[model samples]
Target: MLKIDDLIIDKEFEELLPVLTPEEFVRLEQSILKDGMLDPIKVWEEPGTGRNIIIDGHNRYRILKKNNISLNYWENYKFMYADELPTRDDVKRWMLEQQLGRRNLSEAEKYEMVQKFKSVFEQKAKKNQSLGGKGSTNLPKVDTRKEMAKATGVSEGTYRKMDVVMKSDNEDLKQKLREKKVSVDAAYKEVKSTDQKPITVKQQIDRLDKRINDIDKTIESLQVEKEEIIQRRTSIFYALDIKCPVKYRWDKKGYSNTFPCFWKCQIYIENEEYENIFGEYSVYYNEFPSDCDMEKIPETYRNDFRMIWKKAHDEIKALQDEVDKKSMENAKKQDEILKNAMKLIPTDEDKVILKQFYRVLANTYHPDNKKTGNAEMMKHLNDLKAVWGI
Candidate 1:
């Protein structure tokens, strides 16, 4: 007597199931249309709510609804309820096991299911400990790696390599692993090779230099944007024929504390036309005694002024904060570059000899000397000195 509408689709439970491919879905739909629901829909009757939540046979349920077929029409249609699963975690474990048992899953999908199973096992273990219970379920012990390997039908070492492959940033490698186009060993080796490549000192300096340049450019851009906002705010104040508030000025000192008072001042009131706008609200000098009711202002001016006011203050503060952060980052990068460059210098004991050698080289290759001058050698010597941070 249960109707299709009576069954609930829990999103959390549904997400645990794999999505069917278009071709697979089409085949399933066609089969149901012809065969008329052979497999039973397994559901869980949630206590208190009394709702039959679909835990299995989601695809069959979807097909049936799409074709407007009623569950009552088929005499063989069955409903298998999961009455023993008293908790959500129990249901999740069951779902994961069902997914692991299916033979259609790709390697990537199987690996992902094992990971989910491991996570659920850990969570259940923690819950049991908190409740002073021991060995409640047959879930694996602390050594999840062994369990994961067994579930995936691979050795522990191979499972470890598979873990590395899954966690790597290479999307193509991951896709290949999923499709069985690449082995876990190959993908893991590639990732390790890429990560193990050492960065030379020169490369490190170049990277730091590039980062400093990028931060400088970002600060410049933010400054330009801040200037534009200030210009717009100035124009609005000018159009209103009122002197711009000192707090609103971009160059004003202690402006952050004073800016909030601008909305309440009699300056916005202008002449008698808007005098009573403040009404019972008292306006004080240089600061508002109470909250400013912005709704009293004329719609045309209020919107524009409020927008520009907020934009001007917020943009300026945000720009300053970003610029300060970038400046600090730039300083750190410059310091790092200096530290790397200093590493090229000789030890203290060799400093005197090294300086003497450098002096002789500089004199011999002096670009300013008419007879001894060798411009190329002088340039090379200077470049060496710069690299050593001398």
Candidate 2:
């Protein structure tokens, strides 16, 4: 009798983009149905809880359960003894690294993996600060894309644009990218174009040539709005609420018997129970008083936590700034295209036709522009072109 509580899947790991496509999943399910669990599921037993946690073979386990299939737990699965447990971070990081290092992931998948890995990295950094000194951060001031891309076996630029794609928040476009309907460069451009501000209907109904001329001014307004939005969106993460006077026990086992001690915290991220995602972090707190009650938490540790917490908040601000800056720059190109195309639009019925609007919009977004050329913009541009038969 297999109980549901016997194993819990790591959502932090499983929520990553699916490695298996629909066809691949079908094939895997078929193979498992016929072979009857040839591979053993690897699980870990939690200390003191006497509960088994699944570390791998999640897909196989799921398929079997869904089919109401049963097998001998001891005979069909592998378990780790309590003393040999890997931390939640360890299991997730190792599994992701293994997949990235072993598999030939698509550029899209690689980017998604990096984004997921980064959050895990950030969580680990936060944990480190909580355990050790107060003013420390794990990530150095370097090009993250370059380092992570090297790890993923891709170019830095490739990963950078892929990061842009993840930020785009359009799954249909992402699917198109996967299907080769869109290129990376075009996807980035599409993101920017979509950020274009909506104009008032009166201005939209104004003289065509005048409206084109007003785009530059409209773009400037959008730039200001974007800056305001970024400034207003500096976000903060929840800090660990301390249960005062945290107690601890120590040991003295040296030749001269010097006592070495460290610090630890039981924190829930975002004021929510985060145990399913991870466990509390522990680190060497060299500055701890031998007989200390962590009432105030040491200054060094506080400063470290502050640095990590503030960095996460600041990074969100910085990201918004970067996005707005890019949008402002791209808006300039799009407006200029409309400005030029307006000069060519004849003052006839076609001038105000909706299809003509699509046609002009398509030309501006086309990937082969001399001044605004972006091969990556082709898929989106083609969609606009199709509307007007251009």
- Candidate 1 residues lying further than 4 Å off, grouped into runs, are 73-82, 131-141, 197-390
* Candidate 1 residue pairs that clash: none
Compose the digit string of candidate 2's lDDT tens values, residues 1-390.
556446777543465435577788788799988887777777766443355767667787788778877756765577766455445446556657766776676677666666655645555555665655655555343454565776556687877777677555467888887666888889878866865866567645554655565465445544643543433331121133542222222222331222122223232222243211112333233222222333333442444443443443344345446666777889999999999988765554643575566666657766667776566676766665554344
lDDT of 2 at 317: 44
- What is the overall TM-score of model 2 with all chains considered together? 0.42
The 0-to-1 C-alpha lDDT of every candidate, in the order given, reads: 0.65, 0.56
Per-residue lDDT of model 1, residues 244-300, tens digit only: 321223333334533433322222333334321122222222122222556544444
List the RMSD of every prediction in angstroms.
Answer: 22.7, 30.1
Which candidate should be chosen as best, given lDDT against the real structure? Answer: 1
